[model samples]
Target: MRYRDENKVLAIREAAIDMVASDGLENFGINRLAKAAGVSPATIYIYYKDKEDLLTSISIEEGVKMTRATLKGFDPNMSFKEGLWVQWQNRAAFSLDNHKSAEFFEQLRNSTYKDKMLETINDEFRKNMGNFVENAIERGEIERMPLEVYWSVAFAPLYSLIRFHNEGKSLGGRKFKFSEKIMKETFDCVLKGLTK
Candidate 1:
């Protein structure tokens, strides 16, 4: 029997994410990931049932980390606009701070386990988020709409910018300059349309 250090597990998780990001899921292989992580394939099997299972676990972990970062310093009782700005700031900071992890998250969004990972987020975080939405609606800060719509309206712009920024190219392949100014302006534009 051989010891499986937890760091090796972390390495495996990160390497798997990097592999999928660079190679796409179709080209991702456990053998290649093992070499990248400096661990054997058997070590990965010990932790995850299979490639699908490993990707699922990584998806869950990344979502939780990003969710937690987004929730920190979040106060549902704040003025509606302030709360929305805070959430945007948190999200932007996370995306900028963890470039590789954010890219991995982008890849996971297209994975088969995407919905499963989203449906299984931390219960407390989910509940708090629900409460925030409900409270905002009750206060008439936002229009009556499904949570999905709210999520799309609020975070979609930031994510769109993050994606392009991460790739260092615009959707049209033009040179693009990214700045905090653009993010704040984009948030204001989205917020104005969402508010009553």
Candidate 2:
């Protein structure tokens, strides 16, 4: 058996994310990733069974990290407005600070691996979000609505803004910059639309 090195694993994971985020999953390949990680193809096999295994493992790890970051200091029992505000702040910070990982997730979600990855999403994330929505409806802080409708209204705008920020351009080819004030203003509009 070959000895496994932690540094090699970290390098492989980081290079995989950077390559996936920049060149996209369609263009990604194991040989290319091995070169980028400064490890032999066989070395990658030491840590991952194959390319699919590598991608799935990295995606699952990143998903867990994202969930932890987004749920930090958040409480499902909080008022709808307060809870949502916390979520927005947490999500924005995580997305911006780890834009490459965020981009990798976006690509993964749209790829064939999405269904495979979805099966491994942190159970606590689903449970907490579910509880948060139920609590909000029961408290009369937000109207009762389908989960899809609620998610669309509550989080889609934030994601759109983040996309614009990542691209550094919005509609009409205008240069774009993201700011806390802009995020807060957008959140207010979403909050208004969601409230009872």
Candidate 3:
């Protein structure tokens, strides 16, 4: 087996992220990424054979980073409501602060066909959050349903809100105004739907 060059791979990844942020991923290309990273185009080919390979790699990296960030500082002992609210707020805060990352993730979600490699990369995130959902159900705090359903309830709405904000949607007349109160309310609503 060949030893993967970590520094070269990292450079290409970083350059790809920058390109995606500045211009949408559609505008990103291997030649442009190589130029941005100060490496030969062959270097990019060495790391990733094509644009799809690079994009899959980028999606996986961003997914892992966002998953860790979202689950950061979560306390296992907190009440289900409190814990869920904290999770919601954490994700919302990350989305607002890192719009580019959020957009990139949303793009991946909207893709028609799911790549196996990308799906494997997203599994850790599902597993982590599913643990929390399973625990809550085991304690009779929430209804016993498929973890995917619970995840959709918890996260899809938040993702939609982030997309709305990114598109410059006006939230005027909204009582929560995208504050803690809003996060709490949204979490509570999701909990109500999930709970018995």
lDDT of 1 by residue, 78-122 (tens): 777888888888988998888877767667778776787776577
**What are the runs in model 1 whose C-alpha is more than 4 Å off?**
none
- lDDT per prediction? 0.83, 0.91, 0.71
TM values, all candidates: 0.86, 0.95, 0.69
On residues 1-196, what C-alpha lDDT tens digit does candidate 2 reach at each position?
6777899999999999999998888878889999999999989998899889999999888888888999999999999999999999999999999999988987898898898678666789899999999998898888788889988999999999999999999999899999999999999999999997
Model 2 scores a TM of 0.95
Report backbone clashes per prediction: 0, 0, 0
Worst 10 residues of 1 by lDDT: 100-109
lDDT string for model 3 (52-168, tens) is 887887776777777777878886556678778778878888888877766566555655314633664566566766677667778888777665776698778777666666665
lDDT of 2 at 26: 82
Error of 3 at 195 (Å): 3.2
- The reply for model 2, stretches above 4 Å from the true place, is none
Per-model root-mean-square deviation over C-alphas: 2.2, 1.3, 4.5
